[model samples]
Target: MKKIRYVFYMPVWRKGQWKDNFIGYGIAIWTFALNCWKPKMWKYIRKHFFSHVEMWFPDEDGKFITMTPEIDLEPFAINSVPQFTGQCFSSTMRDAQGVRFALASEVLRNPRRWWYIEATVTDTRYELMLLLAKRQEGKPYDKWGLFTGFFMLAPYLQNDDERYCSDVCAWLAWMANILPKRLWIISPRRFAWLLVKNLNRELKPLVKGKYNGKIQKHSRISRCVQIR
Candidate 1:
């Protein structure tokens, strides 16, 4: 299957108001799932942002090099309503007055920033992606990354925000050698159990049932621990 990309930009409303675009929730979700799935999530993100952004390199010898391409955006359409919903009619406000939503061209430049953010989140800091996504569902990568990239770039908080997220965060804090308590690991084993559950969807269930319940079973048949 050829690799594809999708990006969904979900908006956040805090206290019933628009917050940061979709990056807020999308970041957290991607990161959490990646950390849960693979412990080396951060390493992957670090390589992408600081290192040269990669594109397919061509050589008869099968060597690949990275390249940067000029990707532009469609001009912002003014006097236009939101694509999916016209909710902006009421929320669109201007300085000293309530006006329609007509964003300037400079404001549209966030797309490039989004590209960097998405790439960074997916590269190594997948957990941060997950955390960001927890706030809203209509995120950028959630749609764009899915519709275009065909990857789960858009964060899905509902899917990964529960106990498993705590597990991923806790593990990240632990790896950083930060106190686990600050990361809320009073129930490390509890979060671990949830991690195993979410992981079951990706891989196979490392241990069945609840955390404590599966402890003995895991100990007895412990051979290849996938979520360790």
Candidate 2:
């Protein structure tokens, strides 16, 4: 079992042409999914410039692993399901520029300009265990939650039948007491910003240095969260 030290990966893209862009347009699609087609969400997406976010952890063998929900393409249907994948360092650009294998430590250095935040969750092993065990196959994607969330109509629309990337992360955060049970929920962008912001306020800065090259360990930050 892993101790649940986590890192987040966020991709950024440079502009050129439609076909040339992946991260940029990818964000558009994801943000639309997150916000339920809310026109105002575009402003927030543009403001943050983040398209996708994935959770990472170090395995027993010290290899970095990623857990995120992805669209499962089928013959006539598609769905989103949680998947465990290997570490990939690429911009998803036209040519997959700057792709490489990066360790959890090197992510903070951000050679590709990705964002990273670290925190230790109490009993993360148990949380991850529960997540894996409780995962049900054919769990429908919460596509309707998008519309409900966008219109601010009914928060009850989010069902237990499906799993979304941020929804799963947010649920774990709540279980760990890092977040509270309340009216407003969190999206991937919001969860990323909130968790990092909260940890920065509570923990001491452990490492800071100048930007070097790719795969270089730039900064290492640590903080402990008291799970209630």
Candidate 3:
């Protein structure tokens, strides 16, 4: 018999829950259920529950902030419509004006669409991963890499300069020695699944209402656990 460890899932909107619960470096995976354009495409193409991923870490002040590779079309397009022309840019999760102080506040606007898993790593590794992610800020989003790696089944086509959502997450895991370098090309859903599997825990939702999406058969979705 083996002992199982659990990774508790809680609502991101709940006040003080983030600071009280997640005190380590973690990764958050978002779903397309919110009617977002990019997420909808990811949901349709990947057919997975999670479409995008982002990394979160506490700043020097101990307030958590999210870092992700997003497609910003403002620089290249006339309208705000997102397209392949949008380059990948590393930035903190922010609003239209690009002001973001903490991850909890941002997710509070739509808590149901997000869930996070704390990575099990040493403090040294966490620092290294954070540094690696910071260096990726302002990098171009890998449009061709997304096409060839996921659609064309040729991950080697991906260049070192630009990266997609999951590519950046996978790269961080690889840099921290948590995952092998060979598994560089990965989908957001696949990466989350791997984390859950590696942690040997099931996702126990803390809030009520349905959150499960089109997950694979092997993926486990436990009943909601009320936090009193």
Candidate 4:
């Protein structure tokens, strides 16, 4: 059996330590339970441990860049793409166009808010994944689909038109041929569980630290930590 190797980093909030342990294409999981405002639907009701997930890759200059679909109300542009307004929420539903980019350093400013998981990918696949992710630079966030699909109310609502955090990551993996086929709709916690279950290996810290991170050995899911 091929073992998938991964390094789990503790929530130390040290930029220098994170910089020294950078992986060109690494996946980061954000635990919303850490937030002061709780996501009642995702956490308490649905029982999901993770709130969001994002992937990062190094640019030509070797600077890491993070990509994630979020509910941004700001106007932004990427490359030759015309400037576009981001997602907006009204009395009813949310508007489209929520893809956002940021320097890895900026996103990792509060390492305590996220759990870093570095997976091994081949050079060719890494390049392909980066290319595929860039193509979604201006995609919209699937606000409605997130809830509907999760509850199995409208599975057909799952499309490429818009994507949530985990949807984007799953789409990229499918597009890059890492996954056999697209996972239409998946929660961030469910996705992380799948990865950990399929990839047989012991979890260890990426950097030496006095603080230790723990993951449930039976379920392979990390306990959510409250930030405040």
Off by over 4 Å in 1: 1-4, 8-18, 21-37, 47-109, 116-228
Q: Which lDDT value does model 2 have at 146?
A: 36
Worst 10 residues of 4 by lDDT: 83-92
lDDT (10s digit) by residue, model 3, range 1-228: 111111222223345667422321122223222223344245332433544455555444433322223444768533221111111112222231121113333332233445556556777786676667667766666656654533445556777677766677777777776665546456565666666665655443323465443322222222231221
Candidate 4 local lDDT, 1-228, one digit each (tens): 111121122322335655423321122222332222434334321332345555655444433222323332456533221111111110111222366554444343333444434456677776676666667777777766665642555567667767677677766656655456776656555555545544443323222323234432221222232221
Worst 10 residues of 2 by lDDT: 219-228
- Backbone clash total for model 2 is 0
Local accuracy by lDDT, each model: 0.25, 0.44, 0.44, 0.44
Candidate 1, residue 153: lDDT = 34
Q: Any runs in candidate 4 off by more than 4 Å, and if so which?
A: 1-48, 59-97, 150-153, 202-228
Q: Pick the candidate with the highest TM-score.
A: 4
**Lowest summed lDDT over 10 consecutive residues: which window, candidate 1?**
82-91
Q: Which sections of candidate 3 miss by over 4 Å?
A: 1-48, 59-104, 150-153, 204-228
TM-score of each: 0.19, 0.49, 0.52, 0.52
Question: RMSD to native for every prediction?
Answer: 22.7, 14.1, 16.8, 15.7
Q: Put the candidates in TM-score order, highest first.
A: 4, 3, 2, 1
lDDT of 2 by residue, 1-228 (tens): 333433333454545655535544554465547655556445444455454343454454543433333333566544332222323222122232222234444444342434445555655654553454245323544555533555565467676565444565556556666566532445655665566555663211212344333331123221121111
Clashing pairs in 4: 97-140
Candidate 1, residues 113-203, lDDT tens digits: the string is: 1111101112233334333333422222112221221244333322222322223333443443232343332122223333334333221
